[model samples]
Target: MFGGTDDAVIGFSGTGGQSLRQQFVANYAAKTPYLGLLGLSRSPTTISLPDGYSRSFSSTLAGAWYQGAQGYPASLTFGGYDALRGNTDSVLTLPLGAEITRDIVVQITAIGISSVGDPATPVQNVAAFIDSVVPEMWLPQEVCKVFKDAFDLEWNDDLGLYLVSDSQHEELLSQNATVSLSLESQGSTVTIDLPYEAFYQPITYPLADILDGTVLHYFPLRIAANDTQYMLGSVFLQEAYLAVDYHRREFYLSQAQFPGNENEYRIVTVHPPGWSHGLSTGAIVGIAVGAFALVVIACGLLWWFKYRPRSKKRASRLSAKSTEQDRDVFGYYGREKDGGEETYEKRELDTAEPGMRGSIASRCELPSPPLPQYSPGSPERDWPKDRGSIDMVEMGDYLTARRVPVQSPVELSADSEHERRPPPVEIA
Candidate 1:
């Protein structure tokens, strides 16, 4: 009743990706050696006969009805309900052409019902036993499609062994126990999906995760559903890369999975001249360390200049005191003439020690004082002895070089970064 009536025309529509045969044949032809798919009957109407192999229901020929026409119904008008499977009568296969289109065509048949029951209106209900019968299921298609779509393999006539992707299977698909139609690229496989309840066969996912491969588009299925009676249902076939010798009617099958790139794997390569890779982390630390070293060196120089001068204080105390007195006595900082006639003249002080200058001036001066002259032998008559002062330049071998003038420590300036230098004193 869902498909309408058993005898009524049941129209179905669906879509799918490129047919496996077209894809397989195209790949094999790509090599320099030329080949393609073995063309079967372009369209199959009935499995009853191979185009012209039909004969009446011969006793020995009933096998051909199921095997030839029924089992191999690649193309037909409509499909029949497999009473056993309990699944809707929808069979699918690869469609012609490369561009993905849907609802191209499918197989269906005429069903029958009888309208022979009499209708009687009852005012009082009469006791009657009613027995309803459920349809029997011969559901081979359910078991066939559900398990067959997991993978595709082919025996290589040239290699004589089945080459399959064992690692990829054990990883993403097998562990998850999930299945979808996956198309292959060079080294990776991507899944295709669509919207709507009919397409929601296995599971559900967001629109973002489904836009991967050329396979499993919705347009073809939309086209497949345009029929009034016949509708090609969705098919489940992994990409099958096959090989065919076009000249020979018998085409060979191989794991076309390689071409579709279903179950693909990715391998990243990092090649030669990788020398700079290890240095990146060290380079960052090196910059930080270099900055710290500069700070330490600058701080050390500042400490030495500011504090080193304290060590030379004792040696030059008298010399420094004499210079200060000379400046004040003949200075202009606080002195001025009140009267119009000047009473004093200004003179410059020679930066020399009193010990040497006094000795030289006394040597040439006339001395007439003779009162109480003590004999040289008497210790009480001797003048107070003077020790000659040491010249700073000649005191020690270590101090021979001219020392850098001590500068004040560089603190954070008012502007944060600008360091100001103090003015040097005039030495004249």
Candidate 2:
């Protein structure tokens, strides 16, 4: 069974006498927030075919979480990625971490906050893992303190969260700040900017043990005791696109784009390394040039056969008529008393149909509509207030029920001493 209602039975192989299906069937007792977890790892897996053979599942996986209230739906694609969801020009590919548990790790150089009329203020650097399963950013305590000051956040010791008060929420909305994270991997860097709306989250019962059963607004952040706990979670994925090629042991990160219209979405297949469409650049160009030449030749032949002969016949007829009228003209001129002095009448040429010119002129000279002005407190200015709630409940039950106990703060360390590897090849 998948996604609650969609069910299918297939041969799945795994170790420890437990197949993928068996694991999922056993997960009901765990009462996790997600109905199922789609495997995106590069490990070899196979699907049994009706023809008594099996085939490997795709090696590439790409996806972006739905930007709640922002009108972008979650998307997942196997073997390729949705090109329109990610900025292709800014893609940064890095080799997977040596440890399987920390596959998608990157060194976060800095986290900055930028508000209207204010310059960005960046905090210290840290190495963080990007994991969508987690619901909040687990940063060093000092970084969390910086965030608290920047956003006027208050820590709820009882709840273990940064809870926002009504006035503080309003202030943040009015300020309209953006959080930017500068990430580096394999010497390549990319900055992902998350608007205020991305962090405008709500906490509800079941997900958060709200005894009053009232929804609360909070920033998704946690203070990590050590480097192992540092994580950029699903909240960060709201504005970042991730593509992983398990086969090649590399992954890519790019700023996620949320187009206003569905028509703007596009998918681009991530072909395997050393793969080709069996055509070279020169071959493609040659084909295009040849096709254009053929079209031109066909047009020339069509004009010669269909219109040129008729044009010649019409010209001959006009010549004959002119020859026949020449004598009549001369005869008329000869009989004229004014020595055939020609008179010509000057008349203005109508460049357009009677009303077309007047309408076009009127339209061209008309004033443009005045731009709409909005006051600071107007509904238009307070757009985030009207944004839909981000369903924090979907983040998973483990967030509230199985959270790790807070440990004593440990001194933060420089991430530069970590091992570095060469950058991975670009995925097309």
Candidate 3:
């Protein structure tokens, strides 16, 4: 429970291994802490807890060590975890509300009947807390009275809530107005804007076996004592994110992101004493695979580009050599048949012109017959110099035969002398 209405102070003491127990719990997701303000000196009374090892408390948040007088501090020294809410964005900083101050105030800016937008009002400072246990806002009677006339709200004593008729609800939603809070600290003030839909609370009832479909649309604001300041409560926190640092004496608040919004999530881990930091197993594996894939792709591209030019140069050289050989042989080139036998193409030569015979025989390296000359006044044909013609001939039987060696007749000894001999012929 919050100490917004009256003065409340509690303390404990023990000695010789016997200690008093206290607890401090923090919910980072909800942005609230139980027993967070215990040691923070509140208004009308100062907050304290047991400090000795024998008389101490257990806590999830990091605790601070006090080095001063037994009860209160002459020169108070605090640490970061005294009211720590964990690390958050610095742009979310909000000014301190009137909690320990004498006046119970929850000042905020809202639209007036004669105003076009959020207008300045006399009630600009109100005491409020981002409470998790409560579901709605609880305001002082004076502030509620003003909202009643502005929103055209009807108070239902049976339901103990301010209800809006269907027509009024439509009119309020159509205005598209917002309630904003201004928190001041140092020399700057941060404003938090809450949309009108943040306060639409619907309630249902079940009568016997049947159900009454009466929907109670409300703004989630309750009337409290005049001295009691406003409570911002969970209704305000549902759409807001908050961070508090007691050691620095500062808090931060910003509008929360919706579920569908894209965001980068970075986990903030709190390390107790003796804990070390290192990379996780999954993260290490991901890095190794990514590096390997990049290396493989780069090597493949380099190899292909290096060999492409060399292949093209080799093909061009072979093509040029083939063209030269074809011209020297008079278009007669060997074409391999099956069983390794070579075949050649034959072309017939015509002897109608005088110069055609010499050109064809010279290019094919063959003997040429005599050509007839053209008579006077006859038309001469202009033949291209680069082209030549050759006559096909049967050369199988004209080819030279291979030579064979013969052995000479040998004379024997005395018995072989009887062999007859022929006389030599006289030269004429």
Candidate 4:
């Protein structure tokens, strides 16, 4: 009879209660040394509710069995898996075998000791079933021999196990060998690496029948008589994670992570196809906050571009109007002439016609004292051609006699007669 939590019992009720029977056999035979079995099958148990409604229990099973002092605590998850217990990125998913006799069968392509400096044992299309009911791995005789030679293990005929002596255990520990098992199914391959510590299972009491109270550390490996007996038992699970989806007949295998005391529990739910379990409160709130933030940003942008202050635009328009008023009808940049406006003292050339070039010199001439005449060979007449105009030097001496500051000289060329006119002066 199946007895446990209602959910556990109900989950196995549909799968023929085979899990309970297996547990019974394992417990009686002492096959499972650590903990009892927990079935994670796809079977659904239907029960009638008080309101004449029926409910069915169906969920996925995911777990990891970690042993030894350095291993993490064992974890068994229903309806989901612990994300922290396995490397989710390296998980290998494969469909379950079609045979009714086999449940979680996979093809083990190769097995080797990575640190032993020896070639891998070629398994070659060997099908093996994974079970947690038994504690040791039942591999082919050739593979067992290879493992024995590599690990220096001794086969005990009385115990029917590969036992390791103290010296052998110490040597193996110092070597720190890692056993790699390559599994393939449905064209997908995954290799799981197990440290030497994973196989060093201690045998004691009823399991070993040791009367002297000596704990014998043995390598958990058995020789299979035929291919049909090939099995990777609980020892393999110590380093491999397993998840079963009975509804879809699919299973997954991944390298188990052992973080010891630093490990955290992170459960991720595995939902069935077409099943909907509405979003959590946290998720809903997060989405709502994100949507609200987007709306706020959009509104802020709309206000900035469409509804913000138009002071800059108004200022631009006013400046444009002022500019238009300042321009004459010809579009020249000057203020419009008005009556009674104070007119500035201007040179005679300011009123001259544009084409009246010949009259420019006479119009700009002021009634000043005449300059002293100089001989052809005199210093004044032969002054450097690079110097400023002669008129400017005489003006400077004149200004100095009157105690006025001399202004900067303006160079004038004889070829540019039209450019010699004085600038218009403003009246006081």
lDDT of 1 by residue, 1-428 (tens): 02221221111122232222321111222212321122123333343335742233211100011122222111111111122221112212222322122212211121111111222111111111110110111112322222223323222344322222335333423333322223222333333221111111221133213344422222111111112322222221111111222222222212212212221323222223433545576788998899999999988887788766765674478778886686677572355566765333345433332324245332223232233334564432342233122222432212221223334455576886666644433222
- RMSD of each predicted structure: 29.4, 52.6, 21.7, 21.6
For candidate 4, lDDT tens digit of each residue in 1-428? 23333223422234333232322221134433434334445454333357742333332232232343333445677888888887898878988887655678988888889667877777875788987766789988888888988888898999888999999898888888899999887788899998898788788776677666788988989998888888888778878989888777798999987654434578899888878688888999999999999999999998888766575688889999885664433244443355868443333344343323354433343334334424456555455544433343345213211112224546689897667765322221
Task: Select the stronger candidate by TM-score from 2 and 3.
Answer: 2
Candidate 2, which segments miss by more than 4 Å at Cα? Answer: 1-35, 44-70, 116-125, 211-213, 279-428
The positional error of residue 386 in candidate 4, measured at the CA in angstroms, is 99
Relative to the true structure, candidate 2 reaches a TM of 0.52
lDDT, candidate 3, residue 313?
A: 79
Candidate 4 segments whose C-alpha is farther than 4 A from its true place: 1-35, 43-71, 260-263, 277-428
TM per prediction: 0.18, 0.52, 0.38, 0.51
TM-score order of candidates, best first?
2, 4, 3, 1
| Prediction 1 TM-score vs. true | 0.18
Q: What local lDDT score does residue 343 receive in model 4, on the 0 to 100 scale?
A: 40
lDDT of each: 0.28, 0.67, 0.49, 0.69
Residue range 1-428, candidate 2, lDDT tens digits: 23233223321122122123332222232223432335566665444357742333321222233243434555566789988888999988988888777889878877778863445445556878987767789999988887788888888888888988888788877887888888887788899998776776788765666557788888989999899999988788878998898778889999988776534557788788899979999999999999999999999999999999999999999999995576454442333335577532212332222424245432223232223324455443344522432221222211211112223335445676755543332211
Best by lDDT: 4
